[model samples]
Target: MAKNKSKKKYISGSLLFLLAFCFYMVFGPGRHRHQPKRQDTEIKNNEAKSSKDNTPLRELTTFTGKVTAIKDGDTFEVLFDGQPEKVRLADIDCPEKSQAFGKNAKQYASDLCFGKEVTVISTGKRDRYKRVVGTIITADSINVNREMIKAGYAWHYKQYSKSKELSQIEDEAREAHAGLWADAHAQAPWEWRKEKRTKKQQVSNQ
Candidate 1:
């Protein structure tokens, strides 16, 4: 009778141990499995935030208005909807006001469309200064942006423009020694701007 009692106690303990093991297999691993799904959800959320941050501010559009002011070779002001909006010429970068041929570039642009009605093929993008970025078309159907490069008053600004015609015209102008290209060692407007900024930073640091 004592031997039978001992066997029953051992069997009861083994059954309890098996039940505990089964419980751990069903519940313990299931909890860890949910952790990966939470991590995946977090990763997806971060990707969505990154995509939103890189989106453009606006869509592309066109606007027609009178050229009210010429700020420089590549920037001007247009009288649109009874208000003056600054416009930055697209696909071209002209010399700075203090750079070589800068005055010539400004004069050429002024002669082409200033005080005349023109159309702007706006990329609907605004620069850091809140200027509208676009291509300008004069009343005479001339593309002012192309003319600037063709005449060598401006660089093709390849970082922003991929127009084959503009690139080809710029090459031809360089070969012909047109406008700024007449200078053997002409500095691009972007480089000039960078140098100026560097000088300003150095001065400030000092």
Candidate 2:
């Protein structure tokens, strides 16, 4: 009788240990798998937040200000809220001050808006130099950006603008041999800047 009782007790203990091992094998890995999924979700949310923070916020902005200074054919300074804010003409790129017809483009812009109260309709985009990109409307209700293209002093800047009116104006100017169009080979401002950078790099290499 004593031997039988000992044998029964040993069998019961062995059964309990087997049940515990099975339970752990079923639940342990499942719990660990869920932990990684939660971590992945948190990481994705953080990445989305970081991307939003890095992007620039843009809106339409308008203001009326006096043309305080003319920087070039496509840029100028406007007095707004008692400060001179630099404004870049949207949808156009003009010749650099050193390029052919560059001086003429600057003079044309000055004649159109210098010392005049102009309305600026900005796309609220800032260039690398942080100048407001926009259109300038003179007190006489003239669209200065359109006039620049109409006179062939500025390129339509198709990469940034898709205005058909501007495209047509540029075509008319080119056909009439107006302003810079008079030259048989008028290079775009972007190409001109690229050439200058290449030349500078070559000089530095020397």
Candidate 3:
């Protein structure tokens, strides 16, 4: 019985060692386990948090509205919930004001939401600007974010996207070379803003 117990103990130790070895190999704790911080990574994380904070909690209501107007790729004010409220779609980013396709992005959004009563879902909070940030869906289950990308009018803002559904659609849009994908390296609206701020700071310092 003692011998049997010894064998079991040996097996358990071996298994644990094997697991530890595998983990190290996979995650690379071999020599340098530290990863340097990257500006891109930092920007992505910030955008992600902003995206999370911008998603609605649980659409408090489902209503319809004629897109009285489209503000940009991510904003629109419709006669929704019996009152006109500006909405910013959650989890997607579009071109910046000075970027190529910026106008196209806004126009595409207008085309999709301008005359429709979209079903909005909550995941986050309204901005200080009072834009209800949420996912908008058509009665036909059409995702407005995807529609923008699929239509070749936008890019999938993976930096801010947390929804698996949106990610997949965005991936498809990329694979298919739709919209902003036409540009080899289209700068995201958020990133552009960040760059602009940095440039302004540099100029001020100089």
- Output the number of the TM-score-best candidate: 2
Compose the digit string of candidate 2's lDDT tens values, residues 77-179: 9998787888999999999999998999999999999999999998687888878999999989999999999988999999999999899999999999999
For 12-74, candidate 3 gives per-residue lDDT tens digits of 999999998998888775534444446667889999999988875334444566677787887
- Name model 3 segments beyond 4 Å from true: 1-61
Cα lDDT tens digits, model 1, 1-206, are 99999999999999999999999987888779998999999999999999988765434469889999999999999988787788999999999888889999999999999999999998588889878999999889999999989888999999988889889999999999999999999999889999999999999999
lDDT of each: 0.91, 0.93, 0.74
lDDT of 3: 0.74
> Where does the lowest 10-residue lDDT sum fall in candidate 2?
52-61
- The lDDT of model 1 is 0.91
Q: For each candidate, what TM-score against the reference?
A: 0.70, 0.71, 0.62
List, in order, the clash count of every candidate structure. 0, 0, 9
Whichever of 2 and 3 has more TM-score, that candidate is 2
